[model samples]
Target chain A: MRLLIFLARRLGYSIFVLLGLSILVFLIARVMPGDPARMAMGPRAPEWVVERFRTEMHLDKPLYVQYYYWLRDALQGKFGLSIYTRRDVSQDIGEFFPATMELALFAGIIMGVFGIVLGVVSARYANSWIDNSVRVITYMGVVTPAYVFAILFLLLFGYVLNLLPTTGRLSPGVPAPPTRTGLVTLDSLLAGNFTAFFDALKHLIMPGIALALGGLSQEARITRASITENLQRDFIALERSQAIPERVIMSKYLLKLSLIPTVSILGLDFASLLGNAFLVEMIFNWPGMSRYGIHAMLTKDLNAIVAVIMIFGVIFITVNIIVDLVVSWLDPRIRLGAERAK
Target chain B: MAEALLEIRELHIGFEVYGGTLKVLNGVDLMVREGEKVGLVGETGCGKTTTAKSTLRILPMPPARISRGEILFRGADILKMGPKEIRRVQGQGISMIFQDPTAALNPVFTIGEQLMDAIRYSNSQEALGRREIRARAIQALKDVALPDPERILECYPIQLSGGMRQRVCIAMAIATEAELLIADEPTTSLDVTIQAQVLRLLGNLVQEKEASTILITHSLGIVREWTDRVYVMYAGGMVEAAKTREIFARPLHPYTQLLMRAVPKLTGEGIAEGIPGRIPDYLNPPPGCRFHPRCPYAMPICAQERPPFFPRGEDHQVACFLYKG
Candidate 1:
């Protein structure tokens, strides 16, 4: 009962936070020099064309009017039309958002599992060759720029090795079949077209691996450090003296204790995965939010840009709230007094 | 004797330091009866804890090496037991409460979860169903005299006071009714009032369970109040052993006498005079008797050769050159 209330309170706070952040980001993106009216007008457009464009985009309205109108329309699921594509902003997001979400989900799983396993193994064999080797790899992953790694992966896997697809979500010749679920991989599998599913998997491999690589190292290092510290604690020693099986100690005690910090980091990493996907999308020419967002920015599509930013904001805030709830659950001490009071 | 519940024979625990093998426990021998309360007393660095860890086979590996020892629990050498056998014995035959209660319970776990885990570890089959486990947990909490066991079950360790946490630890230790309970300075971390409460609680629980306990502490006062028998360790060796009252009333070894004098009494007017000189460095202890350098009645022979246990009275032994002849 208390948990439900706590979650409800957190979710309410997150919505307000995301709403506020979206407004701020919308204003900042607008203030960045380029006039959406002029950008939409193009080089050969006349004064009247620019004026017609401003009226159509609602740029002629006051700043406060524009924000209020945008917020109201956004609530109603009308994000307005994209000035660049001359299409509804919602349509653009609907078309591309799921692909980004699927990629992020896959990367999150890979990073979370691999990172925790490596961390446990490294901590268990601390100061040994295995520990040193993991540390070295983690350092490399953290220090190397994401774009550099992405380009390197593209060169090695996409260009030179030719083992994976270089561009798009599926093969060029394949007609993208029917979109039942919007997610290429799942929809392909649902269609029972193994060949199409395989092609989608190949296309997904490079980008997912590139994004996961950065997070995996950090997660592994954090888990290793946390577990190592936990291992030195008195409770761990007491547990050992109790003659609990090593497996029980690792899985039940150490892993559970270590996971408190790991879970929080994983939540933040999942959110960051969305941000990182932009670069990955660009490198692979993947038709996802990053590509759409870039086009919106270049063409000064105010409604599309605001809509995309708001969606990202919502995702980030929602993830953070989930992380907070998970942390509280994992560590009962946090809610002890509160439950008693209730 | 029908067979001691726990027997440590010629146990030698040491660690490999940069210099050489630093012996922590040198040929230490002790035994506990099935339901006896044994007080293992020593100053810091006297290897009392190392001896306790050796019995549980929980000593850190590599640097901490048990050079020679046979830790017999119910006539079986625990050191020779495999991992699985050892685990079965742990929490079933022997359980331990550590010095710091805050550090002893996992911070992430609630007092209830930790207690449940310990209970499950001891009797997993019986603790199978959640309802049964919850009932047992409540009973365990009640046994420790915790208020509102139901509410406390939902509370984390951090929310509880130090005294409450220690009680939770004690409750978990006794939950299984293990044959032996090793409490290493369990009350040292609490305040005087709480310490007394914990000490009394431990005594009551030990009696209730009819279990033997190895209470390791440096305070002779605790020895007088809690233990049935006392073993005084000086510089990695047992200097004296006797019934608690007898040892306190007529301490034979100089080290034991000095330790007894060091205990501050509320009835006394003057400040307590602590023993002089620090514990000898274990890296390269003095030859002969490790205590010879500090012994007031040190003889030439005492400085050259270690003294063996000399019989003093019924169930009394002293290791000192003065008692040798």
Candidate 2:
């Protein structure tokens, strides 16, 4: 019951934040120096045609009026049409957002799992050659941005070594899985197509690694530092004195105690990945929303830009809320504002 | 005579600090016989806690090093024991009641789960059924004077009060039925009234179970009331050690005398006066006796050579030039 109440409060705050983001993005996309209608129609298009497009979009109305209709339509799940694609912005997002979500989800798995494991390993072997190596690797991972790793990885492995496929969501010849979840790898597994599943997984690896490396290294460093500090804590000494096996101490006690900060960092990293994904998706031609978002921004596609921004905002808020819930679940100290369900 | 339950001999501990080694424990010797309550008392940072933690060998390495020591438990050299042997002896042979109850028990685990962890680690109780473990956990809590042991088992550490949490820790220490219990400043974090109650409870439990203990604290009153023997540490060196009554009755070392003077007596006296000099820096400690800089009767000879432990009375020893003759 307490968890539910806490979740509700977090969800309420997320809604308020999303509302603010929507207004901010709506204004910023308009304020930028470009005409959405002219970009949608070519520069040689007739003036009457551009004017007609603007009126139909309610761009002729007052800014506030335009926002009001935009918000109302959005709340009803109708994002206005993309100026360039002439397709419903919501529909385009529905198709494209899943790809980005898949990349982020897979990357999030890599980031969280490897980050924590490496951190714990480093801390356990603190000051040893192994620990020093981990520190060096994490430092390099952090200093060099994720896209640099992506490009290097592409050249070295994708082109030179010919180890993994670098481009597209699935192989051209392989029939795409029946479009259910929109994440091709998962959908392929769901359809019991092991070959397609492996193929989709192959395509995911490079981009996922590219997107996850920075966050992974960051998590490892933070986890190492936090766990190292926690290891000094009295409880650890007490546990050691109690003769608990070293494995149990690390797996259950030390890891659980040290992981709260790591998980919190992961929340922010996942949200930031939405922005980072633009480059990775473009490089790999993964057909995620980031690609669509970049195309929208270049053409001054107002509806598309606002929709994409709002979507990112929503995702960011949701990740934070989930992280909060997970932290509270893990660290009983943070479980506040909930009556103990007696 | 029967073998000592725990013996820490000529122990020298230091930290490999930024500039140089910080000598924390210097030529300290302590012994706790079976069923005896020994108090290792001193001001904070005097290595009273270090001596206690050393027996378990849980102090962090790199920063901490036991340069020289032989800790014998049940005639086996703890210092020479490998990791596997050390693991066998830690909870089964010796248990520790930590200082801070707030941070000692994990906040995530329930009171019951924490208690069960101790019971499970316990060699004797590991073979018991689940029902038997639960019953013993409840019994352990009851032994510590905790009410509603069953309900508390489900509640998280955040739900428990400081005293209650400490009682839970006490429960864990006692649950294992380990031969030696090292209560390091156990009551320092409790209310005065609660402190007395806890000390009394601890005293009773030690006596009833016939378990040896090393109570690490700065409380002279507790030592006087509960401990059979007392070792007074000063700047990581043992200044004086004697029967609790003997030390209080005639504290020969100036440091020990000053420590007794600082304590407020229940009867008439001026406000407690602190000792004149501060604790010496471990990295660059006073050359001779670590306490000589603060010694009221510091002769020129006191700065030249460290005072040997002089036998004073029945089982009484003082390391001060004043008592050398």
Candidate 3:
């Protein structure tokens, strides 16, 4: 009962924070010295066209009035028409959001599973050759920026190696697979054409690996440090003295204790992946929301930008809230304090 | 007439320190019969805890080298057992209660979860279901005299007070019905009153279970009150071993005498003088008798040759040149 109440309260607070973040991003984007209507019309357009465009885009209204109207429309799921595409912002988001989500999900899995395993192996063999090798690889991953890695992967895997398709979500000749749940990978599998599914997986490999490169190294390093610290603790020694199975000690005790901090940090890493996906999307032309957001920004599509930023902000906050609840659930020490505060 | 429950024959534990190998326990011999309560008393840095850890085969590996030791449990050498066999003995044949309960239990798990895990580890093949396991857990809690076992089962280690946590630790250690229990300074972290209660509780449990116990502690008073036999250790070596009354009544080793003098009396002026000087560094411990430097009556031979155990009376053994044949 108390856990339910606590989760509800946390969810309520998260929504409020997300709303504030949205407003801040929205106002900042508007206040930037750019006339969306003029940008849309171009320098050669007539004055009347620009004026009419401004009014239609709600740019002629007072700042507060524009915010209030936008908030009301957004609450009703009506993100006003995009200045560039002249389509509903909701429609644009609905089309591209799942693509971005698919990339993020696959990248997150890569980062989480492989990153943690490498970390544990490295920590368990600290100062050994294996530990040194993992350190070198992790260092290389950390130092090389994601875009640089993405470009390198593109060149190596696409042009030089010819192992994967150079660009896009699928091969050009293949028909866009049925969109049952909107994720290309899932949709391709659901459509049951093994050929298209493999093509999609092949295309996803480079971008997903590019997205995961930096975050995976960081996650692995963090897990290693946390697990090492846990190993030094007296309880761990006591557990060993109790003659608990090594597998149980590693999997049940050490891994469970180490995951609290790792999971929390991974949540933030996941949110950052969304931000990083923009560059990955541009490089690969993946047709995700990041590509849409960048196109919207360049064209000064105010409604499109606001809608994209708001969705991203909501996702970031929701992931953090979920991470917090999971950490509390896995470790009673955190939950007891939370319960007491309630 | 019955064989000893645990026998340590010429036990030698050493560690590879920076300069060279440092011997922590040198040819220490001791025995505990079934159902006997033995107290191993020593100052800090002595091999008392090392001896206990060796008996359970739980000493830290690599640097901690048990160069020579035959730890026989029911005439079976524990050191010869495989990891699985050794583990089976741990928490089943002989369990241990650590000095600090707070540091012993995992902070992440509920008290009940930890208890059940330990219980289940010791007895998984019994096919006890979750409900049955929980009932057994509650019974274990009740045995430790913890109030509101159900509430405690739901609470984490941080929720319970220090004394209550110690009780929980003791309850878990005793739940498996091990043949021998090695409690290493189990009440050192508790307050005086709580310490007394825990001590009393331990004594009663030992009696009820009819199990042998090796209580590793520094307090001679605890030894006097709770144990049947006491082994006094100084400078990583056993100085004396005897029936508890005999050791307290007539301490043969000078170190033992000093330790007895250090104990604060409850009824008297209570001004007790603690043994002066710190324990010798183990890396370069003295050659002959390790305690000779601290012993007031150190003879020339005491610095030259290690003294072997000499019989003083029935069930009494002292390692000092003064009593040596």
Candidate 4:
């Protein structure tokens, strides 16, 4: 399809972003205070053993040469040894990435759907009390931090009211569902463990709400503004003059035409959710890759930190490409512009 | 006139602004006879477009308020009609094509989709099949003399030229077979050559459809060439009204005479001069004659009190102190 070619071009740009991200991650891991080889050998290790470990780990080489070796090994899917976990960085990531994906996807869905609906309703009833009330609520949501909300929910609902769990992915008695997909909720359903499935879902609600709040409000504001501007366009006047049903005009013409900017914002919001979700994950004790990254940061684990950044870079780029494709599909002018350029 | 198709009587309109109400139209009267082309010429912000929009009852309220007036279509007041009643007349009894064609069309839709929508609105009485609407849309395109109507249908509005988009807008209005068609500066957005072509196309199509047309333009040349009657407006009130030839030959009001002098001749015998002063600020418009500030023959009464329309000739009227009863 013509759109496939557009996607291919976007994919090329995303790959370039990943490469830049890889280099940055490599440098950041090097600059942080801690010798990975010494840390690995331990403080009590003999001097010769520490020296051997440094040479083996390429600490003795220049930074560029070390980067080259790391890049080469990385390109082959070998992220090297994690000093903290004593496992391959890629293997640890393989386990945590799915959990992160599941949480982020759920939060994103909540943000996109509720955010856009609130925006449309607000714009539809602009200046009414309902609109004013919704504006106030969304503003409050936007100003509150995700971790603050997480802590609040934990205090109010989990600790005080005793209505929900405070932290942890599942209760002590509930077993982690058998790992087909590694996403607890989905795997629980696959294993027909209704009890575990519900327990996992209960744990997700607080953190999910926290993670979704900021994106939701931001998306709503953007959607409201874009749609309000679109409502005043000359084409809307044309549609009204044509005597097309108001329902059809609002849905088929107004909403679809106005959503391009909103969709673009949504894609970027999805990418940002990764960084924000890290806090939600930490506060709520959700086991996601970001939590693992946090652990690596505290311990100054080199391979693990680099690997996490690279994975995040990949996910962010992928989201951006999908968004570009969706936006192009919404507006035919983009494709026409491509043709003109050609 | 023989059973006027549309008549607007003593129409007053204003906008609610921050500090005060901005009066856009003050006691404006207009009449369009069956199958007659009437030109409404005015400077920008002279309430010409507001008057046209009021006829359809489509002006955005709060910002636009009809303080007092009656807009009558076929002797029935449109202001009194409910939404359903208005809908019946919107695309069938009356339709409007706007100034900027590109802005008037939704960019996301294909030409065919928008055209089909218009066709269905016009053919609402008959539950026409998709095939019938598609055929009529194509036929409407062909009527506008647009080439490759079939291929053009699939193309988005951005792909079409400015002139082609104007043609599509014209086609949509004419295809409805509405009794009264309103063209508000339909050629202003195009280049000079394209402007003439679009005007000619509009003239022919309106004549063929036998629809009464209300052409609002800044160009006096357009008014003289296309209209049977012309109304010259200044500052929210009608300055002069007469048959096109009569107005050009012997314009009664001083504003009308000055407007005639503003048009340049092709031979370039004399310089064409523009009228002095800007349009009055609507919030505090000149109390009496809205054009009194710029009138060469302004009398004491022209500023102290407003001039009522007085008959100058058969079916001709001018609002000025020199002719008022």
Most accurate candidate by TM-score = 4
The backbone clash count of each candidate, in order, is: 0, 1, 0, 0
Report RMSD (Å) for each prediction in the order shown.
3.1, 2.4, 3.0, 1.8
Candidate 4 CAPRI classification by DockQ: medium
In order of appearance, the predictions have TM-scores of 0.90, 0.94, 0.91, 0.96
Q: What is candidate 3's CA lDDT for residue B139? A: 87
lDDT string, candidate 3, B29-70, tens digits = 889998899999988778887888787776766568988879
lDDT of 2 by residue, B1-325 (tens): 4468898788999999899999998888888888788899999989988888888989887689989878999889998898778877886789899999987887667888778877777763347778988999999989999888899899888898888888899989999888999999999998887888888888889988889989999888888888899999898888888988888888888988899999987784778889997999999988888887887799888898977789987889988888777
Q: Fraction of native Cα contacts kept in each candidate?
A: 0.68, 0.68, 0.43, 0.60
Q: Which stretches of candidate 1 lie over 4 Å from their true place?
A: A124-128, A241-243, A337-342, B1-3, B16-22, B108-142, B147-159, B281-288, B292-304
Model 3 segments more than 4 A misplaced: A1-3, A46-52, A123-128, A228-244, B15-23, B123-135, B148-151, B265-271, B299-305
Candidate 1 chain A: worst 10 consecutive residues by lDDT?
A332-341
Q: After superposition, how far is residue B127 of candidate 1 from its true place, in Å?
A: 10
Q: Write the per-residue lDDT of candidate 1 for residues A70-173, one digit (tens) a residue.
A: 88888899999987778898998999998898788778888889998998899999989999999999989877756777799889987899888888888888
Could you give the candidate ranking by TM-score, starting with the highest?
4, 2, 3, 1
Residue A324 in candidate 4, Cα distance off native in Å: 1.0
- Give the higher-TM-score candidate: 1 or 2: 2
- Descending-lDDT candidate ranking: 2, 4, 3, 1
Q: How well is each residue in B64-134 modelled by candidate 1, as lDDT tens digits?
A: 99888799999899989987778767868888888899999888877777777777777523435777768
Candidate 4: regions farther than 4 A off = B269-271
Which 10 consecutive residues of model 2 chain B have the lowest summed lDDT? B120-129
The TM-score of the first chain in every model comes to 0.94, 0.96, 0.96, 0.95
